[model samples]
Target: MSFKSRTLLFVICLFVVSNKLVATPKVKTIPIFNIQVDSLIEQQSIRNDMTQLELLVLYNDALKEKKPADSVNIFKKLAILNADLGQPEDALIYTEKYIKNTLDFSILNSEAYNVIRGSEAHKELSENYMLQIDWISFIFLYVALIGFFFTVIINFSKKANRCAKLFISGFVGVHSLFILEFVLYISNIQYRLPHTYLIAALTALLYGPFLYLYFKSVTYNFKFRTIDLLHFLPTLILIVYLFPMYSLSSNDKIEIMLEINNSYNINRYVIFISKVVSLFIYAILIGKFHYSRRKEEDSIKGKKPVNRWKKTIYAIHVIYLVSYIIYGLPVSGLMLSFPYFINYIQVSIMSVMVIYLAYMAYVQPEIFKSYSVGTSENTIPPLEKYQKSGLTNALSEELKGNLIRLFVEDKVFKENNINLEELSKRLNTTRHNTSQIINEHFNINFFELINKFRIQEAIRILKEDIHGSLNIIDIAYEVGYNNKVTFNKAFKKETSLTPSEFINMQIKKGLYK
Candidate 1:
């Protein structure tokens, strides 16, 4: 199809899909809704003469009227509405409040309205969702720093001071993301509290380039220049944005706040511009890094595995950048089809990729080893076995423990059941170190850690069940196998039993339950 034709079709799809939202009648909040919904909404407020369902409409009506602080009221109403609504797939999906379960993406997806307690409560939806910045977001805010400080300790202990400082800057950059989220949530025109224009613009200034540096550092071995001070250039510009709000009457402050908010939209234009700039910066680095290695390979003539892993690491970085663009760019509301896109800006998804990159960077440091421009593998020694482990943490104890956890214990990358990442999230430790420490202590690698769980799950299913109505395929998937054929081969190799034999033997032995 032609590009114009494809673009036309996409536009049509957006209209078609959005009709349900735009055209649907605003159902009466109480008459059509039930006592259960009323009870649900009632929890948010003690003054419940009007049913909670009534409040949903009140908030929406208020928002339509541009009622100040109506959104804050809506969020209060939603906190109660959410319980009766069950899972908040559609509601929270568009809402700025990122209350989502990371491990189980499906739990909050595709939820249709189910009725109970009589009146058909018809999804008590929000056209403008509650984007309240509360203590909750601050909790995730520290993630960047937590990852950062640990990187510092890792580098400092290794005595790589330059890399440690670079990492600390990157960590500060990452920290600003939460800061941005917090500022937006608080300053959302919907709530209209005393608008902290100072906080809003200054935090935004701090966030953008920090993110740019973080990505560049991981992608290229680019050293921070003395001119790297330019990243803080925007925060310095915020003095102008804050000047208009001072010494205003409450009414005057509202006018000033509106001007600030309007100006903020212009500020959004700045973000889109920065986003494009950041994208170009990343691409240039990716290109420079890619061909430089190819040239080096031509000069030296080494077997490719040494360089091959490095290439894979670069490829993953591209995938991550693409995924970020997929979710992050659209969430900016710049594109025409923005709302139609599936948002994957969840911290968990990003965390998965970040964890993977860190793992690959550590496991295969040739990618990160920072050769001179145009230099190649022809000159450098193949990454040593110890070198692979050492890149993550060079000490023998660190290497042994990491390999054990990565290969033998299988925690971080496990697809199903218990895992290192899951355990870390449960325990709240950084993922890189979990692998590093586990690898150091146990002397296993990541794959072994995960596959062991898969193999064990398969065995338990066979031994514990007598009435095995589900087949080998079922057991394999139940244990998180992507396919049964692989599971059967692994099961046979590991436990001396093909799945069918294992199930049959279990039946004869009466072990199935």
Candidate 2:
């Protein structure tokens, strides 16, 4: 064959083989990325290293190619990823998007809208994405609204003092920002630049001091030093640099995000050093607190109150450490586009510490005193005087005062002939009223009070050297009790034993030693 004939024949053979080997693209199906991206939810199907994100990438590619089998997994993964990163409101939006995709897919299954919708998977498989936004919105609205009101009520409490009030204000502040972000997204009036690391950096920087303050509050009785505010210096500068002119467009936003990420590059290294330093500081504090508290506790006779705040402080400290560690990973460098949930969790922990500190500082100053064992007695005085009054709680003040005065101050039990009627008459009241007062106010009958005082008189007699030889009956009669039986019963009831048993037990226990 000539050169032209041979070349043409080779080309024809190659084209024929290509046609035979390549199967026709099967009947079009929904692309995985479209399903995953649109699926947009937290589902059982995709997890583990957030592998679902990979599926989402695939889904988006498939959708771009107009692949058909409906899937909403991408949005689901994003939602979960956002939540894992500690952005619930962001997660909520992603979930809503996933739901919308499901709700729009098919309405054949009424179960999707039902209250008892089975597993989350069932709901996705059955519905389209459209109906979900409203449902999710309502639920998110309900949660966000409740969170808002609780925030407001917490903010308004009278006992919540100025610093605490500020903390509560910030407590509501973060959630409010979340609400604003959600509202803006839902309204589509604004947009957050995707994969922007600046937000993550700003979050860490902005909340670091707040976190530190929170740490100080629960962990230490914190008094702010000038340096405490300095932790936020990076964020403050970042914010000031955020002139509207600088952020005039998305490019500006991206530029800012890039800058912020770069700052994290700088500060995270510092944060690492700071964390290492913090760990050492924490170790020192632990050792000091342990040593100091142990010495203090030994001076008193009780187990020390654990430096309970240390646990909370340690948690934040660990978070600081973790943030530094995360910054070290290559994935972390890329993923700084969004702060991890750990970042947000650290922020929340800090906020809680702040709120807790505020409570300790202002809302409940008693917390400050709580660490003081000496002050505990002053917090709630014993009711001994009231207990000794002997008048019923139900008695009128005048009657009670008179009763306590006549019976207690004057040692009326010394009069063997003292009777309830006589005492009632002296107080200018009926016997029944006096009886009721004694029963209610003193938690004892009148006779019981008299017997108690008589027992005390016997104790006085026994203490005197001359009366040591007196038998139970002799002691009883001398103390104004008519019979030994009455004295024994009264003695046992008052001192948990008979007179003979009390003296003998006390002697055996070495009180007499």
Candidate 3:
């Protein structure tokens, strides 16, 4: 055989073997195993559906049974399940129910809640439940309560000028009411108790007028006239304007509160602007009047306390005006950029002012006394009253020198029970002559002269008491004041500083020695 013929025969044999292998058939597998596997999966799905149905029934029963604890637990479970099942909207509903039932802000941070946390509903829900106690509002409330008590006491107290007391009472009372409304507004208590709506707005216009009138009454001893009623015309107009809101039902008011952003209409901005403008204008008026009086009081020696008090009051008013302007400009769209906290600062200024006035009322009741420096047409002048006196100028000068010697060298003003009569005896003069000498020579009343000497001595003693052993009452007693109130009054009159304030100032200045 040739070599090519042998190779061809071997290839044919391999091809025949491949054909035989291709023609051969293997054993067949059964379809029953796949069918059984599918059945098991179906059964598991049925069990899951049945379990979910049972949970739903149980949840409904729990609701019907009024079981809050059980309902909350079920709500959480259902929410998580719904989230895992790709039904996020349902999950959020159940989450809201859980949060509403428990008010549990902590739950929103759960890993399982991540599915719905990105939704806007979750954000709103979190905001609704997350409320921190507003400490500033609480402070305002406390001051308002003090203001109320002060108003009641000053109205009835026999001390001080009745007209001044009335004006101050109105100022404090109106401010207190405003603070209360502010508390409601900021703390969201107004939405719950809807009657508080527009109450602050109604009184907004009263702040400037009341404060202006108070300064007038206290400083100039100006009596209230019927024309003064016109100062409150803006307040009356505000009441009329807000009457619609005030007359709304509680539910309607709550609805308005919910949609508060939409309710800031032109009228609202107008009202807000009016409040700030009116307050600023009145503050300016007060400044002008106060400046003129301050200049006059500066010429006099014994008006230090009242002058200082007025300056402090005016400074506080400026602070409030600045803060309120900052707050109001944004609300009224006058200034574009302003911090949100300025409103709080404005209210806090008022609160601090109330607290300060209350303190002064307690410490220096004499400050509220009718200080009529101007001689009214119906009143007798101090000089005129002394016109018929027989006291000679020579005798007056001698008595004045002796009185000065008694106060300066002997420190006789330390006698707690010392009065004009006792002082006259010390100077070997009559009480009338001593009064004339104090008035003419010192340009102050006998009480004022005594207080000036006593306060000067008190300052000397306080400066020497570097050991800090002397308390206010002790220093007061050492200065010939029968009580701490009188002592505080005397001390503040001369130095325009409270006892503690003077000590602190000295400490700050390193002049404690």
What are the TM-scores, per candidate, against the unseen true structure? Answer: 0.37, 0.33, 0.56
Question: On residues 1-513, what C-alpha lDDT tens digit does candidate 1 reach at each position?
Answer: 999999999999999989867673444433322333324444456365344455555544544554343344344345334434553542443232222211112222323223212222223222122234455344444443444444444444332234433543453434334344443443253234434333433443443354445434433356778898776765565545544543344444444333433332334445545544554565566557555555444323232343565465446545545654665555456665454323323443434434444454456444333333343422344223434543343553544544445434553333555566665564355666556554444334455545556788767666666566677878777767778788887677555568788777777776766
Superior candidate under lDDT, 1 versus 3: 3
Error of 2 at 243 (Å): 5.8
Candidates ranked by TM-score? 3, 1, 2
lDDT of model number 3? 0.72
lDDT tens digits, residue span 1-513, model 3? 899999999999999999988872221122222322213223334356544544444444444554465567667766665654545677778877775565444665566556666666555544454332476767788899999999889878786778778877877887888788877776656655777876767778877887787777766567889988999898888887787777777766655555533353326677878888888889999888888776555436545576788788789878887877777777667668677677778788889888998898888776665555453331212565788899887887788788889988988888888888988888887888888888777677888788888888888888888877789898888888889987887677566689999999989888765
Model 3: residues >4 Å from true position, as ranges?
A: 1-136, 260-266, 298-301, 333-337, 374-513
Better of 1 and 2 by lDDT: 2
Worst 10 residues of 3 by lDDT: 24-33
TM-score of 3: 0.56
lDDT (Cα, tens digit) per residue for candidate 2, span 22-104: 85433224344334344434433655544544543454455455433443655555555554444445455666666455432
lDDT of 1: 0.47
